[model samples]
Target: MVKRALISVSDKTGIVDFAKELQGMGVEIISTGGTYKTLNDAGIKVINISDITGFPECLDGRVKTLHPKVHGGLLAMRSNPDHMKQIAELGIEPIDMVIINLYPFKQTILKENVELHDAIENIDIGGPTMLRAAAKNYQDVSVIVDPSDYIKVIEELKSSKDVSLKTKFKLAYKVFEHTCHYDTLIAKYLREKIGEDNFPETMTLTFEKVQDMRYGENPHQKAVFYKEVGANKGCITSAKQLHGKELSYNNINDANGALELLKEFSEPTVVAVKHANPCGVASSDDIYDAYVKAYEADPVSIFGGIIAANREIDIKTAEEINKIFVEIIIAPSFTDEAMAVLSKKKNIRIMQLENIGAPVPEGSYDMKKVAGGLLVQNVNRECVNKEEIKFVTEKRPDEKQIEELLFAMKVVKHTKSNGIVVAKGKQTLGVGPGQTNRIMAAKIAIEYGGERTKGAVLASDAFFPFPDCVEAAAAAGIKAIIQPGGSMNDQASIDECNKHGIAMIFTGMRHFKH
Candidate 1:
């Protein structure tokens, strides 16, 4: 018996050539709508789905592939005697292969001024149904969901007369993944339209496998990268590694964190990230000065950390970067001469993430994973101004201290929970992040700052729960403090600062980074 293959696609690229290859292998080609037209126009033997079902597409083409004949051919198990008998009795031909691609719902909605009706219309129903049915019978039928798989399928057919079971299983998995992602995009859009935060009780997330790393964070664990389904503008995952070694799990994590921190600054900036925390960061008139000040902020921690710059890397900056044993370097662009110099370090992963500084849309949520659940909250993108700050102390912070306070606030916004940043002038003197208590974070910052903490201003991402943090800051010779004054013990903290003769200001905005 001749094997039957079904081909239904919205994207018709290389469809004719693929169908011809299947025809040469004695496989009957069945297609619908534009696929059938394209195959026939190319002088390839094709059987339209309407001819097999004896029914023209109805309901404005939405009811085309919902017929039993198409589904039965796709879902039947060839090894089951009862199924084979039923197929024969019902005149249902076995579909040996299924090639399908869904409509571009994401692209449709991405267009400027797109209407809701057009977006809803682009949501594919029959395509996913066909793919799922075909995938479910992977043991008997081969499923191809991507156009890139066509050539491989043709090659396998020409060589062995049939695709392998492993290849079929992989393709089946891909089909399910593709359909799941398509449905997710549609569902997310619909949910957003209705203004509902509660999603379906059963949640499904789909991400495409981007790469398989050599190992995970350590040598023992295994890991791979999966890009979330959508157009990710300015995402580190979408960046191109122009040169250097393959990125490790830690490298990608640090690089992503560095990029996120750098994205907040419009000016030329450099951020040094270590263990997913910003060890040092500075914005300067030039990229070289930015790198110099950022590196000088904490030379010890900057030794093996990731460095991200918003400006193009030049020879002067590259020379300064080469002095350290940096793990990863990311920038918008790099001069050819700079690349040549940096290439000497084979272990350094260099990435060119052009336009990575694009402003992100407001009201985005940040997610963190715990043992059994996740915590989600809105991102801290609030703008701060000096006039909005309330100086609650007699000794108010000077103008220079206000500038440092704002800069420290920006740095603290990117740190983990219980973050405290101390800065004097425009340089980050010390950063104590990811502590269990604010006082402990303050102590760490003071210890790290050493002599530099004498005249520096402290910026707390959140409000002080008690006056203990303020006492710690005063003991470290900190002259001023900036925080979101919302604590019930705010008066106690204010009294402690007044007794210590330290200046304190409230910005009325919290900057929790965790």
Candidate 2:
């Protein structure tokens, strides 16, 4: 039976009614500070913490419940005679139940320009200590940290006059999980403020559950979505879904790829991604023209793909989008007429991200999970520095072709390796991604581009290993080429480019997306 219950909470959502129910069952309530006043004002009989501990809540209410009387009562085991005898000799009654929630450290830190002292002040010391003690002796004590679990405890107590061991064990598990997440948040915040090393010896990351998906990448796998602790405004997790049933794993993956590529341009741009690879990309003076150019880039491959736009989507863009079966449409904003047209397709996912133009925050990590280890590196922020680009060929590219080459480099930067992109007029005509070899990738892009390859420029994510890629591009009548030029066989490819009068620039940087 729950004879004596201690209640100290930062979140008092249903504490009043819960305390009243416990009091009606003849269970004495012990509270401190605000919780004590809240219960006492509600006309429920309650004992103050100072009365039970014989010590005032000193140190600005920090030393309220960090006493032997509180922890001893909670930790004492009823089944052990020595434990009962020791507590009895000290005149400490057993605490059968504990209700607590920690201070809002996350919310406090999330505030705009919050000070370190204010954030440190909001960290709860006694709350986690009390929760751990009660949870350790869960066989004899019921610990409730979440308000949502109040009805479960109430229902169990009303029927059997006690919380079941199974429920107690589950609640104890939750306490450990909650405390772990809380400690991680505090540690991460302090580490950022203190300017500690980015990658420590022992790294710990915490994320909050967003939702449980129906399946993972495939139907047979189970999966769930979790958002990072402080996800940036530019991230896909920050997008607000206005229409559609729910986002699947593949949908999120492909949409994120499109968004990352779309952030590369400041002008009105549209990016199409299929299976986590860019199928088409384009930039224009207006969003409608960008969408049209992007769609026309690869009309066949873009079917059912994800489209991301940097500007507001209007009715004309929505009408053109409605002509095809698109998996998702993500933009900064959607006009009312655009939404009305897009909403007609009930299966299309519409995501509106307000800060879609924000670049990736500095010092963010790009991580990949491998079989027995993890790979972590800084995110790829730059495609290439314009001043660092070298005109390596005998024939130099014109100013317009240089701009077009830069635009193609941006598209190829996000493509999966081995990657090659054929582009003209600031639009990708063909993108060959994830091929086995460089020449194969080049051949694929040339074949897909066909007649368009006659005057278009080509961009490679990495250096060419041989003259085969240049020979293929020359045969396809490629006007110019851009790639990183660190290969041991770089002279061979450069000689071939010069032999064919094809202008080639060495960016001195490789964007290899494996």
Candidate 3:
């Protein structure tokens, strides 16, 4: 039976009624500061914690409920004869229940211009201490941290005059989980304030499961999607699915790839991804024109793929996209007519990413799981402009060729390793990703591009090992090329470009998406 309960909560919702129910059952209530006032105003009999401790609340209300009287009451195990004797000699009354919620540390710090001292002051001390003590001695004491659990707890107590040990254990575990998550957020916030923003020695991450996927990449594997805790702003993970069926594992993966590549461009752009690889990408003044160019890049590879556009979707773009058997389409917005037309296809998933135009915030990390461990690194968001490029060939590329060359490089960075991209003007002619050899990448891109390869600019994620890629580009009528200059045979590749009279530029930054 819960004879005495302690209530000190920052969130006062439903506390008065809960205390009334406890008082009706002949349970004594001891509260602190705001909680006491709220309960007293509601005409509920609540003993002030300071009155019970026989000491006044000091230190701007920070040191309340830390007295020996309170802790001794919560920690004295009733089952142990010696423990009961010690508590009786010490004049400590056993506290059977603890009701508390920590101070609003997250809320206070999240406000604009919140000072460090203010955030520090908001971190509850006595609350967590009392909670931990009560949870540890749950065999004798019942702990309540969440107000939502009040109704069920009250019903259980009314039904049996005591809660079962199973229920007590579950509530005890909840306190540890709650405190662990609270401490992690506080640690992460303080670490960012200092200079240890990158990675901490004892780092903590939190995630909330979004949904269970139909399966993994294959039919036999199980899969679930988890969204980063408090992640509600950018990226596909935060996107709202506007229409269609539930997202499969492959669909979400490819959609994320398409969205990342789509963010690389500020202009009206469209990117088509297949098997987590970009098969088509293009940018233009008109979104419809961009979609047309991207789809034409590799029509065969784009079939049953994911399409992500940087700009709003119009009726024309939707009509053209509807011609293909695409699995997903994600963009900023869509016209009523476009949605009406596309809604006919029941299986095509459509997502609206509101922050598609906004840049990704700083301190974002890319992570992957490995055997018995995980790999974490900063996202590869750097892109070189015209000033960062070095003209490597004797024949320099013209301004138009330079513009197209940069566009191709943006698409290449999003592709898998050993990737090659051929682009003309603002449109991608062909994309070759995940090849065993660089030369094979070039040949695949050229073959897929067909006649469109003529007068197009080519971009490679990394430097060419030999002149074979250059030779293949020359045969395909690729007028200019852009690649990182890091290979020992870089001079050989440069010499090959000179021999073919092809213009080449080096970015120095290599984007290897393995």
Which model scores highest in lDDT?
Answer: 2
Off by over 4 Å in 2: 195-197
Q: Tell how far residue 314 is off in model 3, in angstroms.
A: 2.4
Residue 310 of model 3 has an lDDT of 84
Instruction: Output the better candidate (1/3) by TM-score.
Output: 3
TM-score of candidate 2 relative to the true fold: 0.98
Best to worst by TM-score, what's the order?
A: 2, 3, 1
lDDT of 3 by residue, 369-442 (tens): 89987789888888775567899899999889888988999999999989999899788888889998999888
lDDT of each: 0.86, 0.93, 0.89
Clashing pairs in 1: none
Model 2, 425-487: lDDT tens digits are 999988999998999999888888889888899999999989999999999999999999999
Least lDDT summed over 10 consecutive residues: which range in candidate 1?
358-367
TM-score, model 1 to reference: 0.88
Candidate 3 ranges with C-alpha deviation above 4 Å: 12-17, 195-197, 212-214, 229-232
Candidate numbers, best lDDT first, in rank order: 2, 3, 1
Q: Which residue pairs collide in model 2, if any? A: none
Per-model RMSD to reference: 3.2, 1.2, 2.4
Backbone clash total for model 3 is: 0
